[model samples]
Target: MRSFTGWTCLSNPSTNHLASLASAWLLWAMMATSLLAQPPLHVDGRRGPYHDHGRHGGPSGEFDLVEPTGAVTGRISLRRDQLIYRHGDGRQVVYRRNGRYDTPDGQFLGYYNTLLARVLKFPRSGFGHFLYADLDDFTPFPQASYRLLHPVGAGPIGGPIVGPWAGGYMTHDISVYGGGLGLPWLAPAPAFGWGMNAGPLGPMPFAPFPLNPLPLSPIPLNPGPVPIDTRRVALPDLPPAKIRFTNSSQRDVNVTLSDARQAGLSKTFRLGPAETHDMKLRRDAGHEWVETYELLSPDGQWITREVRHSIQPQPRYEIVVHEWRVQSVAIDRTARGNNRIEDINMQGKGIGRFLLPPGPELTDQTIDVFQSARAMQNQGTVTPLISDEQIQEQFRPSDRVSPFERALLQQQRAIQQAQQGQR
Candidate 1:
């Protein structure tokens, strides 16, 4: 034994070192094994995919901004109908609500008014304080002078509503901004009834963490022979229907066929690879039929929730045809000039939304993870609803905070808190 600054040392230091190494190796192996045990991960990127990497420009250049004219450095919070601009790199000058401000970039902006202050703000003939600015990018996103229209509102969000307007463009600035939103803003603030309860679109977890989306639980699965959760079917009341989906794409595709929600049991049969999924759907009458192809993103998130109107009986076989909902910014106008900056009032604005179709379906393995989620008529395990806290704990959030994001989050929180107090 050797006496060190501490005390006595191992007689054979090599043995001690070997033991330590063994422990570390064991821990690492366990960690890796656990990671591998996670459900076969996938993401769907087919829906109106936005590559916004400076694509689509005149001849060759970074993608042009939709606004043909505007302060080059300023940003319009379209989701919130707010505009902040500056000519050079000086401090930003925010255009006020129900106000119109001209940008050196040749753009005109109008912020909407709620307190009847609109009539005093813009050209009396039309555009009564509804974002009637005229940057005139020639895009058809409802850009008439009358309160400047925007093809807003997602497809009937709560239920079913297909919007006619194409969505806004994908920009690098917003990407960075949205990333900042992921920062943690726990302190309560005053609420000013901002369109987006979470403030401007920040990257996630940072700003727009307003239960914006419930943290999804990853499916617990081993990457081997896919397990079929034979228990659940589309409709339990109706007779069992047979269904099959073949993965015809060169790349592996995940197909999920869920029956119309009714009765006690809603069946969901999951399949993958090139295999044809043989599943069941309720075979009664009424609104019956599986919604076609909910293409998952590469990361296995549910993309579209389109309701299938066509009802039918099985055995049904569907060929998984790889399709894409090309997404690009376009101009939408009208002779009557209506639905301008419109649907936001209906769809709960401020989340920075563009027409988003559910991307392709990569995988629905989470269906297996929902082993606990199966609580229809108590046929399966009755587990408590997963809490957001539990999810955050498991998936530790990052600490990426930008200076601008931090300030914005604080301001939004203050506004939110104030609003709450008034209520």
Candidate 2:
């Protein structure tokens, strides 16, 4: 027994110390088990649960401006045809219904003719005050002088300014004077001349004050090539009188041939790998034979849907069943302007792959995951649908796992693999 400052303790010092140590060991063991139970992460470099990290605008009609690295830095709100952009850096800009736009600096209300704008390397013309014209001999109007507004926020004056336009630049010192509302006015003002600047609101050089040519256009980002969905394609139907089916695949298949029009007229047969079976329906004179066939796996799993074929029972018709497989593939667009196919290894950690179909349509076109699976089902192949939970599990990372926990997970996976191998 010992007396402390505020409370009295009655226990052996060595037992207390051992109790504390056991509590700590139990806590550490629990934590290690938790870490080892976590699933492995995907190496696909995709945005995980933090995809909407900086997302503030949650409603519709509001879009978060995301950077290339998936960070949300700003937001854009849509009001009919107008767009108001606000950045976290205290900058605000508004793109009006007209070609004009307003910013903290000044308003851009002047626009060159569509034809001349194209020659000056302006962006593609859209609907509104500007005419979406083509490159033809038709010239609607000559280039006119733009109205000069003195105050910064004041609207455009009026009429056009016409003069002998030589290549020059416009130098504006609008930040000198103040507008009525304390807004700074542009210095030297602006006079329309040859195109200056590079972007949408680039300054144009006043005529006869030419310095240098306009800067080159910015390069555009190239996303990987678009994948074509083959499930949407409509295939032609086959109509034959008599048919012979050959199991050209590696696995034995169970097939059922039946008369589609008459019930109780069916035959079930089993075909080994590379084996062939011929089936025919009893047809009367001048009558047509409508037959249907379906396939199943050796384990009694439905592989394909029943397909109807019109047969004549005249010439010998043969059909081959090819094996289907699920392959993991990814598109690597690292090379400039080229999309290359790269093989991926799931290794019991990653998720996703393509279900390859048999025959000519399987060229460079890789089918979509879900679509390919459904297509295989329609073609009588047993395919399992990937769940959303499986996808989320693949995105989970094991970085937080300690070395000891990692070793435990590896040992568990090895044991599982061994058990499977033995089975």
Candidate 3:
């Protein structure tokens, strides 16, 4: 090749030199234009955040597939049980959850490695599989482009490799269910990572810890037995006792006070609800006293009778009469501090299917209010039952019917006639 200096020194030196300088300038301009026309370089190695489908920069959580060329070419939408991969160019592919994928070329097996954030695809022809890394969206390579596997399963083709992108399956703050290629991994993920399906291996069931299994025995926290008291003491002979009586019942009551010392001698005092009465008795017959008290309703009906023979001087007693009383007892058999696994059988079809519906056989026969009241007044423990005539009278419909109800009846009659004609 002749140099620029050589060209300048040729015959007609000035003209030749000018021609060589013009050629050099033209060549430099062409080279600059070509360089400018090329795509921008991604020097940071990190995939830009804008490529995300409104979240992480990956298809694990989204249906849209952002290409390495920053163009959203297609999407992976779910249709029933399979995932449909739709391309912008109108081509389609289907992927099953069992690690089997079908392409335009043929059927292939694919698995994602969450640890490396890459997809390993095995074609139908060979045992080797191609690996497609998670390159930046601005990268020059096309999205579907993948590297050919090494012949002997050597180097980065088959061996496990770790880098800045390793274990960083989620490029952004969002959590992704799967890794690259939007597929499940072949193995379980490590701790503090999102779990993915095991492809043909199915799901990984939870295995109980062998050592230090949870205890299932009941806690030793039962209470002790009740105690019995047995003792006796001599009574002291004393007098001048005081007694207070209260009427806690809803109705008014009359209290009758009598002393054995004086026969046919008694005093009656009326006590209203929540009313209290006090009584003082002197030393009668030298500390040998006998007191009898009786409580009666307003109509002279006996309510309660009590007799007291005390040898104390100033013995104080308080009586309260409540109209109503309630008694209840509860037993708890729940086992506390027990963590045993228990399976509960759920009734999906409902127990109502096996149960008898609400009818007269399943419910108590209703009684008439007037007859029941009469029976309670005449026979204390007897309940009144409704007669057959009363039930038939209550079920009888009225002669009058509204316009809307008459229309419904006419429609029903028409339907019945049509059924009869067809028969």
Candidate 4:
């Protein structure tokens, strides 16, 4: 082949050079156009926070599928023991849970429950079933989705919620339900109770009542036997007693006073080394004092000290420990430090499926509206049974999903497939 320089220098040099240059530019231009024409490639590594469907990513088979003919706008219900699905070609299909049925050879899709099932098929890999898929909005790969029918308020959803899209199964009403097959758990979720079928457009078959409305009985944390009426009333405030505490001990000390003599619940004062504390004592009733005083160190070791003075009534008193002193009564101790776990159980814990958030809130609202111990425990103990109004709310238009989400889901699924292929 003649070199470009040589060809250009040949006869009719200008014409040859112009023609060659034009052809080269045209070829380059064609290549650029082809590159631009190719569809854009995207790896949906994760769903944006904007498109979160509530079940922490990965396909949760929480949707219903219907072949798109024109559009599917209206109520779609999934009643137990009832079928409500059809294919694009008008062939009917049905969904079965916790079991399996025979479908066509190439359509053995995966299963989904409270847990996220593994991706069962590539968008159209032409093989096994695509567990969480919609035909009109076919997902080329199984992008992670979440469980659609969560037990009552157990999910981040409320009322009749619709899913992202609709499409049909590859075969006519057939499926398989594996129990221990790739499953790790089968926990029971809270339910408000099921209702009668309300015909089509019924995605919610149950009305949501508070889960176990009545709170479980609180465990008894008492250390010793209790008097039928051992409840203690708050002590009335009184004037303080005048006293002068002279710290003669070598180390610093802490002084506290309490009706229950609970160290942590009392007011504390730091008696510094070789410091004299002239103060007023928050009057101690002294009515329950057991004549003889036995002083125990922080670690329960015996301490020998004596300083006595009596006041009022007797007009004199004795505080033998020249340092801070806290009184403690003997407590019933158990093997595990307190009551037996069984005792706590017998007292009634876990009797229901719901609980109040930990830590008591002292907001005025809760305090102002007090429920008697008896009343609160038995309040809402029984569910009011699901109603028709609630069933309608389950799949309301606000919750109805459009096809756009499924499309986005497919993109992520495709990316997952690519990564899996590389692996």
> By TM-score, who's the top model here?
1
**Backbone clash tally (model 2):** 21
Residues 141-260 of candidate 3 have per-residue lDDT tens digits of: 112232221111111111112332121111111111222222211111221112222223222233332221212221111011111221223244234445455554443333444444
lDDT of 4 by residue, 263-298 (tens): 345443444455656655443322221122223332
**CA RMSD of all predictions:** 40.3, 38.2, 39.8, 41.1
Model 2 spans > 4 angstroms off: 1-243, 284-377, 380-423
Q: For every model shown, what is its TM-score relative to the native structure?
A: 0.15, 0.15, 0.14, 0.14
Candidate 1's TM-score: 0.15
Candidate 2 lDDT by residue in tens digits, 1-423? 111011111112233444545534543443322222111111133221121212321111344444544355665454444445467797866543333322112211222234233211111111001112223535422121111101111112111112211001111111111122222111111221111222222233222222333332221111111111112122333332243555543433334444443565645454545666654333322222222222222222333332233322222111112222222434455633133333322221111222222223223322122232223444433233222444324322232233554464456556545655665
lDDT of 3: 0.29
Error of 2 at 53 (Å): 79
Using lDDT as the measure, name the better of candidate 3 and candidate 4.
Answer: 3
Encode model 1's per-residue lDDT on 349-414: one tens digit a residue: 011111101112222221221121122223222222222333223221121223453454456556
Candidates in descending TM-score order: 1, 2, 3, 4
lDDT of 2: 0.29
